[model samples]
Target: MNRILATARVQLAAWPSTLGMPWLVLGGAFLVNLMVFALINTSNEDAHTGGLVTFYVVVLVAYVVTMTQYFPMILGMSVTRRTFYLATCLMALVQSLGYGAVLTVLELVESATGGWGVSLPFFGVEFLQQSNVLLQLLAYAVPTLLVSSLGMFFGVTFKRWGVIGMYTLAIASLVVFGGLAVLVTWLRWWGAIGAWFADQSSLALLAGWPALLTLVLAAVNFLMLRRATP
Candidate 1:
């Protein structure tokens, strides 16, 4: 437990760049988005903006780089794979929650200000707007975990197996998605699937699957880490 905390601290030591920079980028993008919308929003319709969504993409890239850049250094410093993996998960969880809380607060503020007087829906998507704070945090946090786990999984895969592994992973993903598409078409389940999704609450749609996928990816990341080199 102490070792895990220690390792997490090491990871957090770079928090300024890892965590702070992404929000900086998000803020800059948001300003630009707000300006664009303000100028063109003649209708004054509170439309959904894609600006904040890019934060998740930033997280994906950040975690991938985090793993690729630091894993070797941490391993060389005598941290075991299990310890490092646990620490990475801890760091990701904490970072996600922190970001989620801030986003939720900003969302609340946006609501109060009526989308900052521009009617731009930057943080408040109608589908994801939850009255429950906990659920809202979960919705925001779950995707961070999912994206981070994916980055970790791929980062380790690349570290352990190089370019060939990435190509294989990409190809495998394509095949799986293609197979699923074919299966859905053959079974005529597209409507049923869409209806099922429609039936589920936004919390279930956003948080539930992401939490499950995060677990799966985390497990895979740990397994790959077991065989990974510094």
Candidate 2:
């Protein structure tokens, strides 16, 4: 247990990229959107932008770096693969929760300030609005976990199999998704799929399904890392 925690601390040692970069990117996105939205002379009071996604993408990229760069270094230092994987998972959970709490608080502040006086709904977008604070936090955090796990998966694939592995994974994903798209088009199931998504509440859509997917990806990462070379 102590070893796992130590490995997590080792990962956190690179705090600039892991802890700082995402917020910096998010702040930049917010400022850019705020400026653009404030400049526009629209009478619509419910203006919203999807600029919040920048933070998540940045975090995902950071974790990919963790796997590609940090994992090999940590493993070379006598840490076990199991320890490294556990440490990564622990960091992911803590980071996701911390980020979620910050976002939730920001959303509350945005609501009170009338979207920073421009009625710009950046954090408190309509689709993610939740009356229950805990649910809202879960909604934000779950997707973070999902993306972090995905990044870890990519890193693990690279460590295990290199560039060829990444290309194979990408091609496999395209084939699977492309085939699924063709099947959906043939079956005319796009409407049903859209309806199914439309029927879900915000919490379920953002947190519930994503929580399941995160688990699957986390499990896959664990298994892959077990056999991964550095």
Candidate 3:
């Protein structure tokens, strides 16, 4: 475990450690979330609709951005592709947990102050004090993992500066949901990347399928990684 962790750390350092990207993504997530909370509370119908857009956009950005950091870093390393995949998976889990922790705190504060209500599916977390903490965490985890796996695939395919694809995915997700708002719907091709994090039902089904898919995809990544000339 320590070796893997150490390896992961070393690999991470090889890339630019500027706080710029991390801050940009995290700040964007929080800012978009705040807007959603405000919008949903508004009585305006437009606000309500806007809130949904906000929600999907934030989820897309958060998932893609968090996973983006790990993908290329893994490939840039001298490690085996399997090891790289495992490392990316572990990193993704940790990143999701971190975001989940912060989001839970925000939901609680909102519920208590009547600022903006946050709810969870598995548990009825309508109020700050009554919110289902575990449920809240899992709710966030759904999209996080979904984005991570999909982002990993992107990263494995495009090593250096691959995070650019994450940004593209985020923008594309925003466009899809936004387009749907106009009632002029089209095929959601790129949003499937966002689907890793934006699934609305049957989380167990979602998780099981994505996890299996990630393994298969990661195996492919491993093969590609082995053949990749460093």
Candidate 4:
């Protein structure tokens, strides 16, 4: 147990420089939240909806970037997969909770100030159970797991994290984003979080499925790493 946490701590400390990126990302996200509160013209409900969608997309992107940084680091490190995966998810969600709080407060302030009213995502176990929360989460997590797993595979295969990160990002961008845009354009999700979002009921029943899937992929990649050893 102690060793699991120790491994997580080591993963956290491994990148002293990338540590601040989350803070910077959160700060920028907060500012955008404030701006949407203050500047957006919201004379109608659709305007409000648009503003909220914008907020969702921005936060999603922030999570992806943060996850991108920490995900690969954890994947590449010599640590227990359980420790690495849980720690990264906890840290990422903690940061998301903070961002959500700031946005929630700003939304209230905007309403008070007669600006566009927006509701930030609430934090807590309740929020986690909301309709497609799992979907929303896995929307980000799917691509993350894929990229992180592939990155580890390539990094271990080639013995170079940077090269792997670069090429993987490029390929992932070309494929994932491209597919999503086309899909969402051709078939809108109504209130759904696009096709990438998983069903919460399904996800809840299959607790640890994400971690289980990630672990299996990681193990497969680890096997590759071992076999490639000279």
Predicted model with the maximum TM-score: 2
What's the distance in Å from true for residue 58, model 4? 12
- Candidate 3, 152: how far from true, in Å? 1.2
Residue pairs in collision within model 2: none
- Cα deviation at 219, candidate 2, in Å, is 0.9
Q: Rank the candidates by TM-score, best first.
A: 2, 1, 3, 4
TM-score of each: 0.95, 0.97, 0.53, 0.41
What do the candidate models score in CA lDDT, each in turn?
A: 0.86, 0.91, 0.51, 0.47
Worst 10 contiguous positions by lDDT, candidate 1: 40-49
Poorly placed runs, candidate 3 (over 4 Å): 11-23, 26-41, 44-46, 49-77, 116-131, 159-216
lDDT of 4 by residue, 88-193 (tens): 4455445444544554454445445554333332111223322444444543334334444444444444443455755875798899988987887788664477
User: Candidate 2, residues 46-120: lDDT per residue as tens digits?
Assistant: 566889999999989998999999998999999999899999999999999999999999999998987888888
Number of the candidate with higher lDDT, 2 or 3: 2
Model 2 residue 45 distance off true place after TM-score fit, in angstroms:
4.2
lDDT (tens digit, per residue) of candidate 1 on 1-230? 99999998888788888888779889998999889878986445645678877888888888888788899988888999899999999989998898889888988888898888878788887877887888888878888888889889879989889889999999999999999999999999999999998899898878998899889888888888899877
Q: What is the lDDT of residue 168 in candidate 4?
A: 79
lDDT, model 2:
0.91
Determine which window of 10 residues in candidate 3 has minimal summed lDDT.
Answer: 120-129
lDDT of 3 by residue, 1-230 (tens): 76568666754563333223443555565566566655555543222222222333444444344335544454565555566556656765776677566656765675565444432111113321223677566555545566556655554445533457458767888998787755533565556746854664444443456556756765665565555433
Per-residue error at 111 for model 4, in Å?
11
Instruction: Provide the lowest-lDDT 10-residue window in model 4.
Output: 121-130
Best lDDT among the predictions, by candidate number: 2
